[model samples]
Target: MKSILRLAAATVCAFTLLALQAVTAQQVQIEGSVNLTPFEARGITLSTLYKVDGEFAGKQGIAVPAPFTLAAPRRDGQQILAQAKPAGGGPIKIYFATDDPQKRIFSSLQIIPFTMKTDDPQKRLEIGDYFAIDLLKKLGENRTTRVNLRRQVTVGGLPAAEVVGNFVNAEGDQLLVRLVAVAKPGSPHGIIGIAVGHPRQGRIKKVEDIYDTSASLAFDTVTFN
Candidate 1:
């Protein structure tokens, strides 16, 4: 009789787990991982990943794979003006929090440098385009990041150039990022905002149902070029 009770309990537990999984499956579908290190090069750590899954990834009649959603600021995402914080010292972890309704909010220690490249620990590479390619190659070993399917309008009001990158977090749940610069009004220099968050996908379209093209949001970054 005792054995029968234990078996019944196990079956009930399994059923609860499966029920939760079914509910979550109806929400966002988890896709492949993308490296946020490039963005991290810019000093942003991804807090969380949220993306449209299933038919949403199908995108109406357009083709696109799901895009990774990124972490939110302190608790508010889309904080374009926040400065990058360094990992004080600890481990960072990543997970999903759907209860927030707001953009993905992530909590983790600021990430330290992967290697002790400098005494400051904050400086790795300067902010600029093409700077993260090497880092991306190093980190993106089995990850397929979302990139530009086609050019769109840039902040500078010019035609969309190839603004691309991946979402990565090192030691913890930090947002790793590398973004291109957007010049202001033909100025030779401009400040670009960088942060770690998944693609917003407001009205974005996809190609071949392979991946949803998205912009990074987990960190704040600016290019010096």
Candidate 2:
């Protein structure tokens, strides 16, 4: 009965592997006082409108429009609006909060249309560097600092970067910020995704889970319309 025993062992191994995969693939959830509505991922087509003189009249200039998907969470008491461009599409503000800065939730994806001059090989940009520049502008030189950074590829095999860190808000509270960026060669715009959450030690897991879910949903579910 040696052959029968071998078959039984193989079956047991197969089942064990599947059980491990299921555990690791479990869905992540947010845990904290502030609850956020689930994020919905969707795709939209983009196109440019032109005047009779061929003048640039589209929200995204004269570039040919394409389709891209973005994920965003529903805002409390606010209606979601979509804006389209030749290279990007998403809500005006992915997340917003009032009265308390620490309680704010955010997730967003955007594509930056790069001009011919900026797209040159010599001038090509690393996604994370672009994010740091933008953050400096918004948070000022003294308030923004790079905490943890990693260079990784997106699910679509596109070049990408991710950074998780903290910045001081105007109210003097430390807030955590997470950013992910993806770039495709010769594209009109590079994709930039961002998420922000609470900074308390007990809430760090929830904040990170939110960011992970937002990024996973956007990258894994996005499709060309």
Top candidate (TM-score): 2
Candidate 2 stretches with Cα past 4 Å from truth are 1-67, 73-91, 96-128, 131-137, 140-144, 200-210, 213-225
For candidate 2, the lDDT comes to 0.36
Cα RMSD for candidates in order: 20.7, 19.2
Clashes of each: 40, 1
Query: How does residue 152 of candidate 2 score in lDDT?
Result: 54
Best candidate, lDDT-wise?
A: 2
TM-scores of all candidate predictions against the true structure: 0.27, 0.46
Q: Per-residue lDDT of 92-199 in model 1, one digit per residue for the tens?
A: 112223233442432211111121112221121222122223323333332644443223334323321223444334322213333333332333222222223332
Clashing pairs in 2: 112-189
Candidates' C-alpha lDDT: 0.27, 0.36
lDDT (tens digit, per residue) of candidate 2 on 171-224: 554555555554446663443444445443233454355454332344433332
